[model samples]
Structures are given as C-alpha cells and as structure tokens.
Target: MTALTTLGLGPLIPLGEALPPPEVAWRLALVGVGMGLHGGPTQALVLGAAPPGRAATAASTLQLSRPLGFALGPVPAAAVWGLAGQAHGVRAGIAFAATAAGPAVPLLTLRRQPSTTAG
Candidate 1:
C-alpha cells in the first residue's frame, strides 16, 4: 500500500468517483491485510494437505506459483496493448491480474483442502 503511493495511483484513488474516500480507504487497507493473511495460510494449507513426502513439493509448488503469476500478469497487457490502445491495454492487464488470477486461486483451494493425513 505504501509502495502504491509512490507509483502514482492517485487515479485509482476515489475522490469524486462513485466510491467515497472512506470506502476506498477501507478496501485498500483490506487488500493489504488480506495479502499478508493469505500468503502464509495458503502455503501452510497446501503443505498440510499434501501426502507424506509430498509436503515439501507442495510448498515448493506454491512458491513457484509466485513467479508464475508475475510472469503471466504482463502477457495479457501486452496482448491487449497489441490489439487495443494504451488505456484499454492497461485496463486489460489489470483485469488479467485481478480477475484471471482471482479465478486461478480457487484451484489452489484444492491443495488447501484437508486430505486423509498431513505429512
């Protein structure tokens, strides 16, 4: 959140738009806290659900996904920018990360779901 301040996200901030400043601030704070809570719990859940020696591998898989998200995020923007114009392309990129990646998260729930045993 602090990092976004310098990134020039004033456009993302709502001062006159439908969302009031208070609402936007609340959501922004939730997003920051949510990321922290999600990270460790997700890793632990994945590892806990894995069978036997696979626990380490499952955790590694989760770690690998971090870079995968980073790598994949720009592709949609590049594609959108190629097909569309500047602003649309940027929106497309953000949608790719916020929505496309959002759905992929449900797939991770499988790894988090309880199994017969935790190794």
Candidate 2:
C-alpha cells in the first residue's frame, strides 16, 4: 500500500502543472491523502521492528526524523523554484518532488529480512 501510494504520488503531483487552482488543490489534497495513508503504517512497522526494550528510542528517533524531513525535504524544490524563476518555478518544484519520491517507492516495497539472532 505504501509503495503504491508513493508511486502514484510521483506522477500525480507533476500532472498538476498548468492546472487551474481547483485542479491543483485536488492534486495537493491527494498528496495529503497519500501521505496520511502511508504515515501510520510506516510508523507502526518501524516501531514493531524495534528491538524489545528499545521501542521508546525508536519512537523518539522516528518523531525527530519526521520534523527534520518536513523541514529539509522542500529545500531542493525551493531551490529549483528560485533558480528557475516564477514562470517555470512551480513546474520545476513539482518535477523535483516527483523525482525525489521515485526512488522511495522501491525502498518502501523492500522485504524485511528474517532475524538472525539465536532464539
């Protein structure tokens, strides 16, 4: 589900280019939906995979990373927007976002390996 949503988002966002305000709003809304759909499940998987006594540490690390990602994720897009000028900035930003999301799909879909520790 996470991989699917992430994959869909890459193309869906860029398709908003040159669209009217309402159309763009819908695309952004879908992006929000996609993020929301994956967020909880991803967090659960991260926490679940944590070693027995380290759940709190895992949770804290996850919490910290979320804000850090939110803050930094837009930097490249913003840089592109600034460099490309207003006429093309929006499209450039969208392209940057799509490009960034593309690689994440495979990572999201990767199978977890079995634990090797002696039981």
Candidate 3:
C-alpha cells in the first residue's frame, strides 16, 4: 500500500510534456484506487495490533499519521524543488517518500496473529 501510494507518482517524473487529459484522468484514477486499497488492510493491522487495552490510541495514532505526513513531508520536497528545479527536485521528493515506507513495511508485516479457534 505504501509502495503503491509513493511509487504511483514515479511515472510523472519522467514525462517530457503535460499529459493528455485522458492520461491525467487515468493516473488520478489509479492513485484513487491505490488509496482505496490501502484503507482496509491498514485499519485491520493497526486495530488488531493494539496491545490489550490501547486500541483507541492505536487507531487514532494510525489515523494521525496521514495528516501529519501531509503537514510535514512536503517541506523538503518544496525545498528540493526550489533548489533543483521540477524534474530532479520532484524525483528527490518521490524517492524520499518511497524510501520512507521501507522501515514501516517490516513493522506492519511482523504482526501476523493466528486466527482464534471456536470452542
């Protein structure tokens, strides 16, 4: 999911000209689909991994990450763009965003709880 969200922007970096309207729409739709695909698994993982009594805190924190990233992550991207111009700077930003997911991916995968069996 994180990979999908970050890497989805990759193709844009290499484009030499503004995309046609249909292509723009198609890419936006793919991003939307990627985001839609992200929600369920993330919710399940965050809520499920809550230690005994911290479910609400866990869920809230999970929810908070999005806005926090939105609020903070763009600063460096903008800085890079200011320094390097659009193509290289945006590539730097995209690379940073994609690599940022690397640490979190292992953590998410580690919580494979066994299914409960009915008595």
Candidate achieving the largest TM-score: 2
Q: What are the lDDT figures for the candidates, one per model? A: 0.54, 0.73, 0.66
Off by over 4 Å in 2: 1-17
Candidate 2 lowest-lDDT run of ten: 1-10
The worst-scoring run of ten residues by lDDT in candidate 3 lies at 10-19
Rank the candidate models, highest TM-score first.
Answer: 2, 3, 1
Q: How much does candidate 1 score in TM-score?
A: 0.53
* Top lDDT model: 2
Q: Give the Cα error of residue 63 in candidate 2, in Å.
A: 0.8
- Model 2, residue 6: C-alpha shift (Å): 4.8
Question: In model 1, where do residues sit more than 4 Å from their true spots?
Answer: 1-33, 104-119
Better of 2 and 3 by lDDT: 2
Query: What lDDT is reached at residue 36 by model 2?
Result: 72
What candidate 3 gets wrong by more than 4 Å, as runs, is 16-24, 101-107, 112-119
TM-score for candidate 3: 0.66
Per-residue lDDT of model 1, residues 17-118, tens digit only: 254666566655655564555677667667767888788788888899967965875687567656766446544444444554344445654534344666
Give model 2's TM-score versus the native structure.
0.80
